[model samples]
Target: MNKHDFKMGFILLLTLCIMPARAADINAGKSKAAVCAGCHGSAGVSNNPMWPTLAGQSSAYLEKQLKNFKAGLRENSTMSAIAKDLSDADMQNLAAYFASLPGKSAGGDAAFAAKGKEKAAMCMGCHGQELKGNGQFPKLAGQHPDYLAKQLHDFKSGERKSGQMNAISKTLSDDDIKALAEYLGAL
Candidate 1:
């Protein structure tokens, strides 16, 4: 290559190497997230029953889901529409913005938490005190109660396949799922 071309290529490589891997403008995400506010919440958490609370979800995981929605790998009408128009940079920025936000608990009902706490004791070893799941285990704290319940049911019925959760969930009854979902929402 010519000297000028070589120098330009080197500069481009250097810029790509030095740029922050997760640098995304939250402001841009805010604008892009407007439609998402209906389900994911203006802040990324959701009050919607079927929709999952995206707050505190792993950025990598959220990015994957967003792409999944767009690709039709995940089935959600609203979410798929939202994802369809997103560019890679838009998805990245959205992930960064949501990941950077603080996670909020919906504040569990005292009665449900009291009952769920008992159930939570059984879960604490892996799920932690606040039910905020660690690596690979999705955070249960403040997750949508309906979504959690559906997952539990899916696990029980083999609708959802997870070698990890399938075994653990086989033991959970419908009642257990209800209690756990209630408790998790409170956290």
Candidate 2:
């Protein structure tokens, strides 16, 4: 084949390969996330403190978490069950839908902020300086204290497995987790 023709074919193939990453439909995501609204809230804020808010979370982080849940890399019974049935497109769309929504700032007790700040210093490495994480790590600021504590507890107990978080949580006391959660929640 001619060089120009070969280049054109290669470009077409590359575009098709990358299409799935760009095919997320926000409207479809909204529709699909209806089921998710039961726990994660209609607008991505959870009514229950035990459930984590999905709104304003990075799309990449959300997508990674959902994919991990489906793959059994992250262990949560409810999330695993829910994620198992989701197609890649569904997960992508859901991430987009939730990320598009406004996030909530559930304030925590002021008393814990000092201790939490000290404890959170270690978290700044991966979760960002302000805890408003990038695409890989999740945003911790403005999250629910209960949910954050639960996740930290789970990480410590080996229930939820993340290499860095597991090791970090292992050294934290109950008070540390509580303080960190409270501080982050208020941020």
Candidate 3:
């Protein structure tokens, strides 16, 4: 290459190296999240337990779910429509925005927590020992109890289909599900 071309190439490479692989613009995300405020609240914490609080969730996990909803891998009628038009960058930005917000905490039953601890052992393999997930696995700690119960129900009923989750959840009773939710939500 010519000297000028070599210089430009080196500069480009240096710039790329310094840039994050999925650089999200938080300002842009705030603007893009306007529509989400209805269900997810202005700060990404949904008042309705059924809707789930996205605040303080791992960015990678949030991004993956958005993509999955768009792709129809995870079927949610409302989420699918909302996510349909989101670009990869938009999803990344939204994820980052939500992840930047604060999370919530819930109360737990001591009796249920004891029972749920045994059940939660299975989740540790993927969700980490503390239930603070990494990458694609969601952080279950401090989530909504009703949301967790509904998700377990959905997994069991095939409304939300995951081969592993379906298999694991199908065996759980209503009490087990409730206990698990109570335990995890309290953390």
Candidate 4:
């Protein structure tokens, strides 16, 4: 090969070696996630109405939340403490394992769901037409109404801060929050 071609090949090889590989291991994630089974369930679904289900959530979203908790950007007593000890790879693995599972429906009140559908129109821009989530947005469908409502309340009250959520939640009343939660959870 010419000297120029040899130099280019060497540079490419060096660049490839310097870059970090980000492939997550699902089995490793499952092993690491055993501690989460108490609340998040063995399959990433939560039976309790208060805890949000992790199943089928986007890996990117899950990883971000874990990072947020670890950094204190998001606050949860249990999660923060747990996340504090996790490495970035641990978070990625856990997110991958959970995202690989199937999500379950929490069901909803018909009347409340009807009202919620109207409000969800504005949410589609970020959350997707089906509310299954986009890049970092979470899947609202099949989530628990109580958990969804609490998040909305937190956003409205400034307990949880998100540029979009905080502003949008401010426009909602208690009943609106409930209706939205019911509608989203049933999907």
Candidate 5:
């Protein structure tokens, strides 16, 4: 082989060797997700308004959030502790399992949802037209209204930092946040 060909082949082999070999295992994820059932249901849904449902959320988004919590980029009393012990593979598996489940809606007030829809136009760019989410944006549709509102409040207060969300949340009034949450949750 030519010198250049040999060099290229070595680089490719090294790159492949450095990459992870295992794909995410949904069954393993389900087993690991047992601890989460208390708050995020066994099926990745949630009964309490205080907790956000994990079902049907983007796997990328779920993985990113778990990493964030582990790295201290995101702060939550419960999640931080839970994420601390998780390995990268564990996070990936959990994200995959949750994303595989179907999402449920908790219908909202028509008047509030109507008002919120208009305000949510700005969110469509990243969150998608149906608010189903794209890549790392997260599925806002069908989330608990209270959970959504709390996240918005945190973003506004700078407790949870996101360049776009922090700026957009700052522009929202209390009523606007409520309406937006109600609207998104109903979907």
Candidate 6:
């Protein structure tokens, strides 16, 4: 899109920010989330450090991302394939299932956590307490290590280009991003 279209798109999308915390359907979500379990983990917590932990994430963010994946705006072969088959209700169900679960730490990996703490201080401005996130910011605490690292890289390199995230990530070093991702996943 051109600059004008980009601006209009962002404004329209932002205006439609759907953080319906109350609109989630946990029962339906449980069923839809089963499919998500393959990548996001059984309880929205992925064991794979490369995948992001989805537990405790904002339903709005999850829903939006699923939409983006399906629309091919956010390019990911795995997520796109998964999202392509989902309906709006299915997205809501999956979002509810993941959001309802309690977030778990990466567990038993403390050495890197300290470094992660320092890096995360910058992140807290948007991600909120415990990285549960607020508004448009996504939950980062207990997120997948690999997902976080990839996103950070994406933000810095312009593959991902949200105004705030891109700005925040630009200030980080590669090591800083790695440390933060590791720490956030363990939360």
- Top-lDDT candidate index: 4
Residue-wise lDDT of candidate 3 within 87-177, one digit each (tens)? 9999999999999988877556778877887799889998989987767889898888889999999999999988999999999999999
RMSD of 2: 2.8
Each prediction's RMSD over C-alphas, in Å, is: 4.1, 2.8, 3.3, 3.5, 2.8, 8.6
lDDT of 4 by residue, 35-152 (tens): 9999988899999999999999999999999999999999999999999999999999999999999999999998999999999998999988999978799999989999999999
lDDT of 3 at 104: 79
Query: Which 10-residue window of candidate 3 scores lowest in summed lDDT?
Result: 105-114
lDDT of 6 by residue, 49-115 (tens): 7788888888888889999999998988999999999999888878877778888777424677778
TM-score of each: 0.74, 0.88, 0.85, 0.91, 0.91, 0.79
Which digits, one per residue and each the tens of the lDDT, describe model 2 over residues 1-187? 9999999999999999978656678899999998888999989999899999999998899999999999999888999999999999999999998888989987888898668988888989888998987777999999999999999999999888888889999999999999999999999
Sorted by lDDT (best first), the order is 4, 5, 2, 3, 6, 1
Distance from true location, Cα of 42 in model 5, Å: 1.3
lDDT of each: 0.76, 0.91, 0.89, 0.95, 0.94, 0.82
Residue runs of model 3 more than 4 Å from their true location after superposition: 1-22, 109-111
Model 4 alpha-carbon drift over 4 Å, by segment: 1-20
Q: In model 5, where is the ten-residue run with the lowest total lDDT? A: 106-115
* Candidate 6 Cα outliers beyond 4 Å, as residue runs: 1-22
Clash count list over all predictions = 1, 0, 0, 0, 0, 7
**lDDT-better candidate, 1 vs 4:** 4
Kindly list the per-residue Cα lDDT of model 5 for residues 115-141, writing each as its tens digit.
Answer: 899999999999999999899999999
Clashing pairs in 6: 29-93, 49-146, 50-146, 52-144, 53-143, 53-144, 106-186
Q: Give me the runs in candidate 5 sitting further than 4 Å from their true place.
A: 1-21
